[model samples]
Target: MLKIGSGAGFSGDRLEPAEVLLEHAELDYLVLECLAERTIALAQKEKFHEPEKGFDPHLEVRVRRLLPLLSNQKTRLITNMGAANPEAAATKIVEIAKELNISCKVAAVTGDDVFQVIETNHLLPNDNPQQVKKENLLSANVYLGAEALLPALETEADIIVTGRAADPSLFLAPQIHHFQWSMHDYEKLGKGTVVGHLLECGAQVSGGYFADPGKKEAADLADIGFPFAEIEEDEVVIKKVEGTGGVINLQTVKEQLLYEVHDPANYFTPDVTADFSKVEVKETGENQVQVTGGKGHERPDKLKVSIGYHAGFIGEGEISYAGANAEARAALAGSILEKRLSDKVPHLRIDYIGMSSLHRTSFGEHTPYEVRVRAAGHSDSEEVAALIGKETEALYTNGPAGGGGARKKITESIGVLSNYLSRDQVHPKLIIRSTDNETI
Candidate 1:
């Protein structure tokens, strides 16, 4: 049984669902994904709020809970939730395994965090000004692709974890570990990589984000299912845990096929080239897709990184009411707000949220009969609050757009922002690996 299991590195930072899978599936391979540029920014925000929080220190606790079960079953796990701190993540895992008397080897894939590495190595990307702006990055992570997994797979690891490797690599690493696949097996490797992508986002392929018109009876979304893979030499079967609820159908598979994936022909990752168009997904049973016919291409020399930048401070606030001509009045009211704020504090960058009349007022199809117009901004000066207050009152009267009553500001705080920076190249060293099968 080429059994595979999935763990979503979703925002809650909880692994309760994944732990449940380990107890039930007796999984041979576990894939976890936790890297998104947005995730990094969120981690940064958490760190900024509590400087000592450092990173996702809580994921380890969840993993520790599963260690005992994994110890009995000997199920190997791989995850990319080690955001911005793989070493720290591994250290915590090691500590847990040692205490539980469960022998496990932990491996980490580094070289993804290039924010500081670039400065030390003087490795920067193209000379484009915008690309160069990445030098000022608050965070830099190369969606490093698959190269990060090679070292860990080569070691004795029962549970391997990583951070910021591509979403699919979480799936590909297991293939590399089990088959000992070579980097150059473009065709077979590519097929394996494609299998990983299909299952990486558990719910996406299981009808959470997409639905099948032909298979209405196939859905059980209330308890949405998670994806799993049955691996073979050249193909994989996509299914979910037995008791879980959800549907995996053609439309759902098709939607996940193109989600954020640009250039299906050249879908790049460190592992193998995955050709989506060449892939065929057939509903083999309820909650199942027999995936095959995938082809891969040559891997790229340089890794692609996900970088983020501090655009500027942005906030939103508004007031709503039920009355006739509400949309128009809301628009006018928003304009009045900006005018008032600008008159009082001209230098402050002012914008009315719902008042797109300052721009294009396309309210889509069902325009709200009773809506709201809000204003917000970012200024390097102390006049920010004053501008907000001034605009709040302007909706009552005077200015280009006018409405009624008092306005509101959505209370929020924006601080040090981040961007991405890529290095031209680097000499990555060996980290450890997970030890499910060890040689003395």
Candidate 2:
């Protein structure tokens, strides 16, 4: 059986859970599935300012903590933490290894960044021309699949870092590499994808996101454990480290199996069009669930690409009100900002926290002890955006009564659009770096 564990789910997931898995899991591979849809776009913004610093902000901390544990074990690490720049991420990892005086090989899988090849007129998935002009485009990355990572695995690298790889593909790549599963074997590929999807979110399947107090009630959630999969030809069991806080059962497995899966029968991925409708999940033991019966058809001819572009600036300000009629006072404050910045800010949004912000409708009238008023505006010009926040903040003495905790800020907004590119257009390659040799 081949054992694989999930080290992280997203860019800012807790580090302690990963440390627990690396210390005790004794697995063959550990995959960290970072990189959300807009994360690369934000990383691209960072790269625009500093060439060498586009990767995950926590990459160094994660590598520094996990590398030593890997040195003494056979477990190889795989991660897409190289958000916008895998080459630089790998280089930084090599430097960290040298600082700790450890010997290891690191491979960076590139070719996901297709900004240069993309055209401004390319139609997006929504059938509209590119939303952002070519000059305003920040980043365009193709979602590479498990096959794109094959060469990096073959290099016998201790760690493989990539940019914009499909989430489940990171786990599926090692399965194909170790089992020597043929690319055409859609059945095994489908089963492997099921395993990848389950464990990709780290502790989600183990109870981090499953807790609902009385309804769900997962125990000791403060120290929840990440999940690992034990896969054989005929069986795949999901398990976690013993004595760790969390529960893995039929309920958790069922929830994660369908997480973000729009269509169970035709889940289109670059590697394969997986079919999970007939998949079976059974609780065989404590913290162990057996999964099977996943199938797949031919892979998609085109790959999904995420394009990032500058979406202008957003300025926001907030203030809190207390005592009787707090909601009325907050509402009046919002109205004041709206009228003041109506002409200057093109798109303005006002919200009353603890009131009508989330659902956009009030839940009957009840006097709240306190409420927060937030005013946000988006504009092409930063000066106009700043005006909304400034006017809202001015309400301290000019408009609202009993207002406190006033805060204001401005930020650049990035817009993302989905598009498709032919698989042939994306060519993934690996760059190897090791303590023994420089980058090659």
Candidate 3:
């Protein structure tokens, strides 16, 4: 059996859980699925400003902390923390290894950045052509598959860093590399993809996102553990480190299995069109769940591309009201800001935090002891966006008797859209660098 563990789920996930996995799990591979839709776009922006700093902001911290633990161990690391610049990320890792005197090989898988291939006149998936201007485009990255990672793995690199690789493909690559599974074996590929999907989100399947206080209580969630999978040709079992906080029973497994899956019968990925419709999960032992029956067909002809563009600026302001008639005061404050800024910021939104913020519809007549009034809007002009928070903060002395704790913020928003490119157009290349060698 091959054991693989997840070091992180998202860009800013806790680092301690990954440390636990490295210290105890004795994993054969550790995959960190960091990189999200807007994350790469933000990284691209950073790269535009500073060429050498487009990778994950926490790359140095993670590599500095985890590299030593992986030095003598057989465990290899794979991660998409490379974001907009995998080559730079690989170089940084090599530098960190040299600083710590640890000998290791690092491979960077590139060619996901397909900005040059995209045309300004190209149409988006469901939208019209050329809706986004070329000047406003931030980044365009193709989602690469398991095949792209194969060469990197074959290089015997201790660490493989990639840009915009499909989430499941990261886990499936290791399976294919170790087991020598045929690329055409759809059934096994689907099963391996299932394992990847389950363990990709780190602690989600092990009870981090599955927790509900009274309805579904997980043990010692404050110190939740990341998940790992033990896989063979015919079997897959999900488990976590012993004595670790969290549960990994059938319930958690079931929830995670369908986490972002839109269609059970046809989940489109860069690697394969996985079929999780017949997949089953059974709790065979404590903190262990056996998964089976996942299948797949041929992969898609066109790979999905995530395109990021400048989406203007967003400004928001919030003020709290407590005690009697708090809801009424908060509502009044929201109305005042709406009327004040509606002319300048046409697309304004006012919400009462304890009341109609989430659903946008009123709940009932029941009043809460505290309510927060928030005014937010998006505008092409930074000055217009700034007015939203400025007007809302004026409520402190302007009215609404108990108003307090006023806060405001303005941020440049990055909008993400989708497009498709022919799979043949994306050619992933591997560049291997080691602490022992100067050239890649």
Candidate with the greatest lDDT versus the true structure: 3
Number of colliding residue pairs in each model:
19, 0, 0
lDDT tens per residue, model 3, 1-440? 89999999998999998888889989999999999999999999999999998999999999999998887567899999999999999999999999999998999999999887875545445683536666788999999999999989998799999989999999999999999988888878888899999988889999988888898878999889899999888899999999999999999999999999899889888878999999988898999999999999888889999998888899999999999888878888988898899898887988888878898866567677899998999998899999888888898889679789999999999888898998778889888889989566
C-alpha lDDT values of all predictions: 0.64, 0.89, 0.90
> Could you tell me the lDDT of residue 10 within candidate 3?
94
Query: In model 3, which runs have C-alpha deviations exceeding 4 angstroms?
Result: 120-130
lDDT of 2 by residue, 406-426 (tens): 899999888888889987788
Q: What is the lDDT of residue 171 in candidate 1?
A: 76
Q: How many clashing pairs in candidate 2?
A: 0
TM-score of 2: 0.95
- Residue pairs with colliding backbones in model 3 are none
TM-score to true structure, per model: 0.79, 0.95, 0.97
> Candidate 2 — which residues are off by over 4 angstroms?
120-126, 362-366
Worst ten-residue run, lDDT, model 2?
A: 121-130
